[model samples]
Target chain A: MAEAGAPIIEAIGLTKTFKVAQKPPGFAASVRHFFKRTYKEIPAVTDVSFTIRPGEMVGFLGANGAGKTTTLKMLTGLLHPTAGRCVVDGREPFARTRDFLSAITLVMGNKQQLLWDLPARDTLRLNAAIYGISDADYKSRVDELSGMLELTDKLDQPVRKLSLGERMKAELLASLLHGPKVLFLDEPTLGLDVNAQVAVRAFLRRYNERTGATILMTSHYMADITALCSRVLVIHEGKLVHDGELAALLRRFGTRRELRVELSHAVDDAKLRTLGEVLSHEGNVARLAVEPAALVAVVGRALAELPVVDLTVHDPPIEEVVGRVIGKSQRALPNVVGAEQGA
Target chain B: MNAALRKMGGLLSVYYAYMTAYRAELILWALANSLPFILMGAWYQAAAGGAFGFTPVDVTRYFLAVFVIRQLTVVWVIWEFDQDVQRGRLSQYLLQPVDPVWRYLAAHLSERVARLPFSALIIALFFLIFPPARFVPHASDVLLAITFATLAFALRFVMQYTLALFALWTERASSLESLMFILYLVLSGAIAPLEVFPPELRELVMWTPFPYFIWVPARLLIGGADVDLMRATVVCVSWIGSLLVVNRVVWRLGLKRHSSMGA
Candidate 1:
C-alpha cells in the first residue's frame, strides 16, 4: 500500500476548470449578457496526476494554453485546483506556509522578482532577510552565485541598467540565495540569445548537479528540455499523454533517419531507391530516408555500389518527431498540443 | 516577529534608497501638496480684517498646520494597490515567503520621511510670508498631535488599502475611491476647516474618520484643547482596530478570489 520513500512532489486527480462569461458582439447583446450572462466551464487541467521523486529533473511539455502554465501555477500555490490535491515536500502547496515557501523557488522568465529601480544586491538582501538567512550565509550565497553567474560587477548596478542576460542571472541569484530544495521554472530561457541560453542551460545543469534540487520545468524551447531534462511529462489539451524518459519518447518516434551521400560520379534516382526512399537527388549527391535497423546496411550498400565520396547520417528532425507524437493524440482532436513544431 | 522586523528593515532601506534616488518625483509630490498654501492665501485674503471667527494670522496658522498634516498622513497605497492587482504585479509577491503588506507600508512611510524636508521648506515659506506666526501650540500638545498624526497616517493607509482590495472583484474600484476622496477633501478639513461648518454638521463630521486625519491635528496645533485630543485618540484607535479587522477579512476573501479566478 505504501512505498518506503514517497515522492517529494505528489499530485492526484488534479482538475481545474474556469468559469468564463459568454458575451455576444453587439451593444444590445452585451447589455443583455451583462444582466443575465451565460457561462462556460473551460477545463484547464483535467484529472492530471503524477509524482516526482526527490532530486529528479523533469520537463513539462505542451503547446501554449495546453495547461502547462496552469499546472505550474497550481503547483507553485499561485492558483488552487478546482478538484483534487497536490503536495510538495509533505506540505499542501495552496496552504503556502512559510516553511513550504522557503523550501521551494519558482522562476518565471517573463516575470521578475527584482525591484526595477533598485540595485540587484538590495533585492537579494531583501530576499535573504525575508527567508531569514543569516548574514554570513547570505554573503556566502550571494558571492558564490554571483561568481558562478559572472554577476559580481553587475550586482551594484540598477536592474534596469543591466543587460537582459545579466538581469536573468541576478534573478537566478535572488531565487537561489535561500538554497531552496525544489525549483519550478517556467520558460526560464525564453527570448534569450543563443550564447545566453547555452550559458543558462549550463548553469542550471551545474546547479542541479551541485544541489540535487528537484526541478519541474516547462519550456517552449525544445533545446532547453533536451539539454537539461532526461524525463518529461507531456500534456495536451488538459490531459497527460506521455510520461516517461525523454530518450525513450525520442527513440520511439524518432526512428526515421536521413542518409546523405555524395558520390564520385552521377547516379540515377531509381538506383538510389535501392538503398532507401530517395528524398532528393542533385547530380551525384542524394538524400534518402532509412529506418533505424537498416541504417548500417543502407550505408554499406551506398558505399559499395555507388561512387560514394562523402556520407553522413542524422536523426529525423526533432521538431517533426515531436509533432507526430502530439499529432497522434490530436487526430482524435479537440485539444491540439500547442504549436508543437519547435520552441 | 524578529524575522518580520528584519525583513521590514530591508524593505524600508530599499524604499529609502529609492526616495533619495528619485528626487524629481519627490519634488513633484511636494509641489502637489502645495494646494494647502493656495487655500491658505485665499482664506487669509478673505479674513484680511478678521471675519469668519478668525483673524488673518489665525487663518495662516490653520492652513500651515493643514499643509504639514497633509504631508504626513496622505498616502498613495490605493493607487499602488490598484496598479498591482490590475497588472498582476502581485504575482511576484505571492511567490515569496514574506507577506507583501509590509512592502507597501514601508514605501508610504518612506515617502513621508522623504517629504519631511519639503514640509520644513514649506514651513519656512509660511513663516517668511506671515512673519508674526507661531504655528504650534504648547510643547505637550504638539507632541501629542504628532503622535495622533502618526496614527492617523496608519489609519488612512490601512483604510484606503482595504477599500482598494475591491479592485480584485471590480475593475472600477477607483471610482469608489474617488467618491470617497471627494468626501474626505470636503469634510476632512483639507479644503476648509471643519469649524466653518454649522454646529450640527460639525458634530456629524466629527464622528467620521475624516477629522482625525486632518482637523484634529490642525486644530491641536492652533489651540491645545484636551477635549479634541481625547476625541482624536478615541476615534483614531477605534477606526484603526475596526479597519484592521475588515482588512483581514477582505484580504482573505480577495486572496481566495485571486487564487481561484487568476490575477
Candidate 2:
C-alpha cells in the first residue's frame, strides 16, 4: 500500500518473457516450419524494480529493444508482468480497476487515442466523458493546454489534416484532460523537429509542475532527459544498468572531453599527438581529447607557442557518453550521433 | 446506481464521438446491414403464387420484423475483437478503468442508437406498404421479444468474443469466425425459420444455443407467445449468463498466459 502522500508508482521484481517463433530462411525451410516449428523464450524485461514519488519527473533511458517500452506498458496495465508484482496507487495494474485507470494515463508517441477522421476536440470531449471530468475542469484544462501547446488554432481541425507536431500537441491535450495523477510517456517527442521537441519538453515540465503529476518518460533524446529529468533510470539488454541523478551518470560515464582547435598554420599530426590524442586533423582544423583537469594548460600551450587560431573545450557529446556507458565501441563517434537521431 | 449511470453516460458520449468521427463509414455500415431486407423482397416475390407456411403478405411482415429485430440484436464483436488483437489496440482498452468488453458493448450500442432513425424509417415504410392482419401487438409478446432480443445480443457477443480469444494462440481465427457465422446462419435461423430445417437438425439446433441468437427472438416478435416461448427465453438468458461467466474465466486464463508470454 502507498503511504499517504508517498510515491504513486511502485514495482517489485517485475519480469516479462516472450515466446517468439524461430524459423530458418529459405523456401524449403519455410515449408518445413509450416509443419514443425521451434520457439524461443526471449526475456524482454528482467527482474527490475523502481519507485516514483508524486510529482517526480523521471527519465527512462535504454537502447532499442532494451525493455524500456515494455516496462512502461507494464506500468500502465497494458501488459501484465510475467513474474513478481507492481502497484499503481495501491492497486494492481493488470486488474485495471476503474479507480486505478481513472488515476493514470499513458501517452505513446506513434500510437493515437484520438479518432483519426474527427477534430481533436471531439476526442477531448470523449476523454473528458471517459474520465468523468467536470465540465468546468475540462474547459479550464483544455484552455491551459491549448495556450501552452498553441493548439487553439488546430483543435477544430481533423487530426489527419494536422501536421505531425500539431497532432502531437493535440494528443498531449487529450491525455491530460483526465487530470491523471501518474503519467507514462513513451518517446513522446519521437520524430518531432528540434523546436517541436523542445516545445513538448517544456509543456511536460510545466504540466508536471502545475499538476503535481508523477511523470515517467522514456526518450532517446538525451537533451529531453537533461532538460526535464533530475534523475534517470538506464537499462541495457533488458536489465537495469544505472539508476541515479542525471548529473552523476554524466560524471561517471562522461569521462572524455573534446578539444577542437583551429591553427594559424596547418600542424602535423605528430605535433598534435604530443598535446593529446588527436581525434581528427584536417587542414588547419583539428579535434583532440584532453584530460579534464589539464584542459586549460593544454589550451594555453597551444595558444602561446603553437600556431593556434581558435580553440574550444567541451565535454564529449551526450551520444558518445551514452554509447560508452552501454558498452558500445567508441571507435565510431559519428555513428553514435546517428543512432541517437534514429531513436 | 449513480456511478453506473455516470459510467454508461460517459460510454455513450465516447460512442457518439466515434460515430461522428466516421460518419461516412457509419453510413456505409447502415446500408450493408439492410442488405437482408433486399433479400427478403426477392424471396417474397419468388413464393408469390404459392403459400409456403407463409403468404407473400405474411412473408413481408415476417421478413420486415426480422430486419428490425436483426438490426437491434446484431453485434460485430468478432470483427472488433479480432482487429483490436491484431492491431494492438486492445492494450489501450485493457489499461482503462472499465472492462474492455463493456467498452465494446457501449460502442456497439451507440452505433445502434445512431442508426435507429434510419432503421425506424425502414420499419415505417414496410408497415405502410404491407399492412397485414397478423401485425397486431400483444403485451406478452412485446415483453418476451425485448427480453429474448437482449439475451440474444449478449449471448452472441460473449460467445463470439470468447471465440476471438483463440487469436491469442492461432493465426487463423478469422477463418474460425467465418465458420461460426456459417453455423449461426444455418442453425440460428438467420437465413430462414428454424422449423424449416429437417426434424433431426431442428432437434440438434434446439439443444444448442444457436436458436437463441436469432430464431427464438424472431419467433417471439412474430407473436408466437406461449409457455414454450417463455421457457426458451429462460434458456436463452441462462445461455447468456453461462457464456458471460465462461468469457470471464477465459479472459482471466488468457490474461495469465499473455502475461507469462509477455504479449
Candidate 3:
C-alpha cells in the first residue's frame, strides 16, 4: 500500500521513442516503399520527470503533439517507456498488477469504453464486476455518482442516443466505477459546451475533495486548469518546462496585466497608448496591457484623468500565460525538442 | 460467485445484448457461412455419378454436418482484435484489471449464444428443402460432436487470436488471416471430405490442426469409421496447449511494441 502523503505517481527521466514508418508520396515512391520500407526513430517524450503526492490535483499543460497523452499512456501501463521509469501507487506501472490497475484509471476524451448500443447502466455494471465491487456497493456508488453528475435519469438510455455531454458523463461514470485512487484524464472536456464543462469541472472538484484521490489532467481549455488545479506541470515539445504553483507560472510568464476601460466618450488611440500598450480600442472601450507593477497606477490614472465610465484591472488570461510558457520553452530548447509531436 | 466469474458473466450478458440488438444482422451473419451448401451441391452431383467413395446421401450428410461445425467453430477474433489495436480501443481493456483476452473470449461466446437460434432455424429450413439430408445420430455421437466442436472453436479462436497479435506491428494483420484462410478452406474439408484426398495426403493433413477445425468434428457427427477418436482428442488438446503458449509469448512481445495508436 502507498503511504500517506507519498507521491502516488512518479515519473523519473521517462521517455518514449516510436519507430515511425517513412512513407514518401508519389506512386513511384510508394511502390519502392512497399518493396523496402524504412523507419525513423522519433522520440515522443524526453527525459521528463515529476512527482505528485496523493490528493494533489496537478494540471498537465501542453500544446498539440506535446507528449501529454503519451506520458499518461506510459503511466497507465498502456505503453512501455523507452527509457527511465514510472511508478504509480508504489508499483512499477508497466508491471500492471491487478492491484496497480485497480488503483488507477485513465480517461481519454476522444476515446470511449461504453457499449454504444446498450444503456450506460450495462457498462456501469460491467465495470463494477471487473473492479470487484459488490452488488450493493455498485448500486450505491452508481446512485451517488449519478446524482452528483446529474445523470441519474440518463443511465438507461443507449450511449449512441445520448448527447455528447451525456456520453462524456457516462464515460466518467464508467471510469470511476472502480473508485480508483489515481486518475489521468486527458482532455476530459475536449468539446463540451460551457455548461457541460462547468458541470464536469464541478463534479471533479467535489469528487477530489470527498475522496482525496490524486489527479493529473490535461486540457486544451485553460479554464479547466485554472478552476481545478492550484499547481501544474507544463510540458512543451516532449520536455518538462515548468513545475510549480499555478500562481508562480502566471507570475513568471504573465508580464502584463489586462485593463479594460469604458470611457464616457471616444478617446484617441494614441492617448490610450500613452497610458499603456493599447491591446484593442473601440468607440468608447479600450483594453490595455499594463505591467503588473504599474496596474494600480494605470487604473487610478485612467479613472482620474480620462473620461472613464468604469475601469477594471485583471490578471492576464491563463491561456496567454500558458502559451507564453510553451513559447519560451520552445525557444530555449529548440535543439533538444523531439522530432514528433504527440497529442 | 467469485469476482472473476462475476466479471465473465457480466461481460457475457452485455455482449449478448449487444449481439442481439440487431436481430436481422444476427440472422444474416449466421447465414453468411453458407459455403458448405454451395460445395455440397457440386460434390453431391459427383457422388451421384459414383465418382467418390460415398454415395450422394453420404455427401449431403457430410456437408450438412460441415455446416453445423462451421456455425459452431467460426472465429472472427482476428478482425476484431486488429480493429481494437488500430483504433486504440484495446487500451481501455488493457487498463482494466482483467486480461483483454477474457473480454474477447466472452464476446465470442456471447455471439455464439445469440447466433445459435438463428442457426437452428436455418438448419431446419435446409432440412425441409431436402429431407434426405437429415439424420438421427446416436446420443453418444451427438455428445462427442458437441465436445469436439467446442474444442475446434477453442483451437480456431486461439489460432486466429495469435495471428491477431501481429497487429501490434502491422496495421493489417487480417491479411495474414486471409492468407492462412486458404489453407483452412482446403484442409478443413469445407470444399470436400478428406476421404476424397489420397491416403498419403490425408495422413499428412491429419497431423495438422486444420482438419480438427471442420473435418474431424463433422466426420465424428457422421460416425465415420476412419476417425481415430483418441488420436483426434490428443492432437486437438496438443494444438490448443501449444498455441496457448505461443499466444502468451507473442502477446508479451506485442505489448512491448504496442503504441496504443489513435488515442
On TM-score, the leading prediction is 3
Clashing pairs in 1: A63-A338
lDDT by residue for model 1 (A1-343), tens:
1134778888787888988888879999988997898989999999888888888899888777889888888888989999989988888888989888888988989888888898999898788878889999999998888888888999999999998888888889999999998899999988888788888888888889989888999887777887999888888778876677877767766567899899888988889998898878988888998998999888888888988899998656545555666777566433322222221
**Please, what are the lDDT tens digits per residue for candidate 2 over residues A85-108?**
888888888877788888888888
True contacts kept of each: 0.64, 0.59, 0.67
> Candidate 1 or 3, higher lDDT?
3
lDDT of 3 by residue, B169-198 (tens): 786699999999999999999898999899
Ranking by DockQ: 1, 3, 2
lDDT of 1 by residue, B187-233 (tens): 99889988789999998888889888888887776774534667678
Which segments of model 3 are wrong by more than 4 Å?
A255-319, A327-343, B259-263
lDDT of 2 by residue, B73-170 (tens): 77777777777777767777676656677778888888888877777766777667766623765778778878878887888888888887766665
Best of the candidates, DockQ: 1
Docking class of 2: acceptable
DockQ of 3: 0.46
TM-score for each model? 0.88, 0.82, 0.90
Task: Give DockQ: model 2.
Answer: 0.39
Q: What is the C-alpha RMSD of each candidate to the true structure, in Å?
A: 5.7, 6.4, 4.9
Which clashing pairs does model 3 show?
A65-A342
Residue A275 C-alpha lDDT in model 3: 88
